[model samples]
Target chain A: MHPTSDKFIPFITPETRHFWEGTKLGELRIQKCDSCGHKYFPPRPFCPKCSSKDISLVLCSGEAKLYSYVISHLPAPGFKPPFSIAVVELLEGPRLMSNVIGCPQTPSSLLLDMPLAVVYEKLSDEIILPLFKPTEKIV
Target chain B: MKNQKLVVIGAAETTSLGDIPHLSQVQLHADGALNALADAGLKISDVDGIATAGENPITIAQYLGIHPEWIDGTSVGGCSFMMHIRHSLSAITSGLCKTILITHGESGKSRIPPPEWPWPPRPGSYEGQFEAPFGTMGPPDLLTIPFLRYMEDYNITVEDLAMVPVIQREWAALNPKAWFKEPITVQDVLDSKMIAYPFTLFMCCPRTDGGGALVITTEERAKDLPGKEVYVLGAGESGETMLISQMQDFTTSRAFKTSANRAFLEAGIEREDVDHLMLYDAFAHLPIYGLEDLGFCERGEAPNFIRDRNTAPGGRLPVNTNGGGLSYMHSGMYGMYAMQESIRQVRKVAAAQVPDVKISVAHGIGGMFSASGTVIFSNQPN
Candidate 1:
């Protein structure tokens, strides 16, 4: 894996350490409430839906649908131009922001509601970002 | 709060707008405060309350030589000033303060030294952890990502989206104070340089330097003031998410709906009652979302409403009559400017003043739909 510290990195906090650890292990982890069976993203301590502390980390199917996106013409630090910044709706019913890889970054190529699967890119030893790509597999 | 009447007795932008490399961020706040105070025919000593965002209230109070009994530092985002207005209304009605001065100033383009923080938020913060890691550059990137989904779901074409700025530019051409006064067409918008997909350079607000302020007092005191009183008929504010990606729905703004609905309920007015409007336009899509979420049009119909010239110069509802943040002058926090235009319309002194505008609604978005605030103003006391 190539070490890329130039990119933005998440400061691992106690609450978010589990999700990051899961990402490093190739598992997409989100919080699910045991009390209300609610699922949420970005790794909060409690369930957003039920405000329940009775929550646990659940593995995502790593399958998703392209909910929305924008292609950047401006340059950023780690990414090249014309890359798509997307929010993918996971099969588990929560949406998260990621880049869509393995496809051309254009309106014609990145179809809305198209099936996508997750692919993790190792940013650094501690950080692995979840990106997505178009898939032919029926969802 | 409803029993008593609170009115904006004084309002003014900085003495000069557009570019002021000389005025530091805090200095812009002081200038706006002083000008608004002058407009109200009062001295700094007359102000008993102070509220500001983008700069600390404590700092601004000391800088303006005001010993405020009440202070607010509600720094939500650009719309923080709108929240300040809402809070000031409550504070004045509660007798927490007698006179409130809300100030907003930003050296967004100038980037003056000190009190300014570093960009690309540090790690350990929520945004740094989740949002920043994705290589999002700024509001133009993050705030605009959701539009594609909205377009797909609503079956809106790119041509429909271009009309928002086109109509707003028409309003801009009439206002001499506006930054971009040149008229532009939908094809012009499409022909401009693309900054982000589906968003061209012309569609985004210019990074300009400016500031604005407002002075609020009860109607009883306003009678002795120097300017026409624009009464705060009703006001409401709400927050949706800290991150744009977390917004509940891409097609509409829950925060805009919740805030404006509360304002309408409090004002006791319907959509038809409002003759003028100022929907913040940091990006072209905001007015589109604002129209739908604020209940001016049905969901997914705002594009056509705008394209049909319903919001244009001769349109039924004159929106963004000040050219808005898009062309007017967005100096970082645009909520102040939005409210200023509403007050100007209600005062009948606007550059493109709509005839018989008894009521005007100013709606603003804080940070990438993170928070929202709506204020309904009326020339009539009732």
Candidate 2:
């Protein structure tokens, strides 16, 4: 497993360790409530809806649609400048906010309601960050 | 189901609204509370009920000197004190307690650095540890997300966003208590440095130092004693504060709309019905965003809604008559000042006071977008 320690640190709490580990294996994962079959994000233990502990980890199809995005040009501490942060609505329903790479970083290239697909990169010893590239440009 | 009624009969404020080196946060609160007690013609002991937004040296029950029969510490936003008026109204009518006092103080401006107190934990601390790590630090920056979306979807523009601080400065020109009194123009706002995209330096409220106190009681208690009586006709509170502060989705501010709706409906008023409007301005964009959210205008049209000085001195709603957080003293929080401004308008003593204010709507938002509270003030009850 490659770790991206020099680039950024992944927040590893007891609840989200599995999702991080799955990223290392090149698999996209999400939690589904066993009781109500609800899919959740950022990974959580009990079902937020019913508080039921019954849940299962499932691999999600690495596809989503771009709902919204911001083209930030300022230079921050870790993340690269001129990067675009996006909120991608998974085909499942819940929206995940993350940065989109692999596509040309330009305002015109970043269209609303654009289709996106996720690709995980193992950068270093203990890190795996997901990057989304424009695919299908769902317009 | 009917909601509770709250009325503010007496109040007082500190004139030394700048840094006063010797006074502590408790002392600041004490100064305001003491004046409030005098305004109500009530003693420290007379206020059996005390309410606060957070724990302070002046606890509802342990302020300055005595204890009260009941205590309520409800802190929503700049509207927290106003919300207490709603609470006190119910408590007084329900035979709970009499003479409810709400107080606030912070040596923000006068002191080089302010002092901390043995108070409650900071509200919305989650955003800092979890959300801020990936950006979204302050309200102005975080809120820019929605502003960007508004730019994409509506007529609101960078120039429109500039109007917020421009008007705030105009009001501050009349308000002596305001920290900044210089006359300004929309061009000045456009010329200021950008704190973030679509928002300039003037687009944010200044950090102010001051305290506000309001005495809430029922008609039975108001039969005697001093000062002008300001009645609360409607009040409500709501939030999309749970998972995130700013409405991450940017569709709308459900919390703001929900509370404003209840207050307006209960007060039996419309946007055009009210003569005065006091919307929080911690971020100048707050009113611009709130105006659109509260139905004063169509979605994505906040920029054009406040195009001119119509809502200024002689304009549409006569908003933020006290200079607001931008020009007026913001104190540590915007809610306290909002309450103070409402009372001033009701008393006809505002530096920028408007005429024929039979109805007033005040709005406040906590955290980045934690919770929003609303109160409708009228000359009479519903």
Listed in order, the DockQ scores are 0.82, 0.20
TM-score of 1: 0.98
lDDT, candidates in the order shown: 0.89, 0.69
Q: Identify the runs in model 1 with alpha carbons over 4 angstroms from their true place.
A: A1-5, A137-139, B114-118
Residue A20 lDDT, candidate 1, scale 0-100:
90
User: By TM-score, who's the top model here?
Assistant: 1
Docking tier of model 2: it is: incorrect
TM-score of chain A, every prediction, order shown: 0.93, 0.87
Task: Please give me the DockQ of candidate 2 compared with the native complex.
Answer: 0.20
Task: After the best TM-score superposition of candidate 1, give how far the Cα of residue B145 lies from its true spot, in angstroms.
Answer: 1.3
Clashing pairs in 1: none
Per residue, candidate 1 scores C-alpha lDDT tens digits across B1-382 of: 8788999999999988898899998889989988888888888999999999887899999998999999999998888988998999889999999999999888888877443433577688778888787778788888898898889998998888888888898999999999999999889999999999899988899988888899999999989988778899999899999777889999989999999999999899999999999999999999999999999999989998998899999999999999988899998789999999999999999999899999999999988899999999999986
lDDT of 1 by residue, A1-139 (tens): 3467577877888989988999899999999999999999988899888798999989999999999988889878788888888889999999998988887777888889899999998889999988898897333
- TM-score of candidate 2 against the unseen true structure: 0.83
